[model samples]
Target: MTFKANWEKADKQYFLSAEIIEEMVRRAYTPKKLSSWSVIAGGCANLNIKINFEGNKLPSILRVYLRDKKSAYHEQKLGTLLKGTIALPETNYIGDYKGYRFAITSFIPGIPLRDLLLSHETYDMDSILFKVGGLLAKIATCPISKDLVRIPANSNGNSGFIRMAVPV
Candidate 1:
């Protein structure tokens, strides 16, 4: 897949400096040297970078959460929980660097579904939809663990103070 550095123009605000990315790379468990990096250009709440390493066959994704520690922790927990059961990438590292919480995950190679649908005029919509449906069905069948609950005890009440619990 050809990676686009869209953050160089429209999404420049979400771009991370090479130094920061290098620091994140050093903090990771991988011994591979940094080759190249570019912003993934979709997320609004976090900065996602596609990182390539020298002598490594697959690239990794580095995500810096802009929301808060809670949001970062929630995502990390979800990634861990869904690791084996789902097709999602395995998170290799999750920690704070220069006050910003980050997570590095093994990159799953593919073009984003939205990008494919928008760019290709003759794309196979039926097959794509079927695959998506199957994936969703599999996800639905996965049991939710009780220990994963993060909602407040009183959040599900009719009281005005609490309305609904939103998952990160």
Candidate 2:
């Protein structure tokens, strides 16, 4: 399904007007001309909106947290601070908010990993297993932690988001 269509399906519940978008643009103080805008992806957590500017350039992504939380903004701030250390998308805009926060960043171009994997007709089962093993091992050894992140405290465990369970 197209990103725009999927986004509409998920975010049509909370409709946002063009004037609100224009206000958001103004609040962001972005120089890019917003010729068009649409939702790219959305979920119970966030609505990822994509904006097409006047330059025929690539679209940018805006993440609006569904719940009232500043974790998204914190994540962006931390990413900016650690840009050189880690490959993080550049944050271009941040919107004005009274309760919920909104932020914009350069769209990270790529298919969702799930879509990419599913789109493949076939794969070497052994190789895929080995790659998954290697990836997990690398992640296990990685030294990332909440300390490196300036995001809001996830004081509320689970926070109504889905959690994955994998058998070891």
Give candidate 1's TM-score. 0.71
lDDT of 2 at 125: 55
| Candidate 2 lDDT score at position 49 | 76
lDDT of 1 by residue, 76-158 (tens): 66665555556787778887888788988889988777577657478678998799898777656544554564333264563
lDDT of candidates 1 onward, in order: 0.71, 0.61
Q: For model 2, give the 10-residue run with minimal summed lDDT.
A: 158-167
- Predicted candidate 2 versus true structure: per-residue lDDT over 14-113, tens digit per residue: 6667777666765785575788888764354577778777976788776776655576767775565455444567877666664547887877786554
Q: For every model shown, what is its TM-score relative to the native structure?
A: 0.71, 0.60
Off by over 4 Å in 2: 1-12, 42-44, 81-87, 117-145, 149-168
User: Residue 120 lDDT in model 1?
Assistant: 41
lDDT of 2 at 146: 46
CA error at residue 125 for candidate 1, angstroms: 1.3
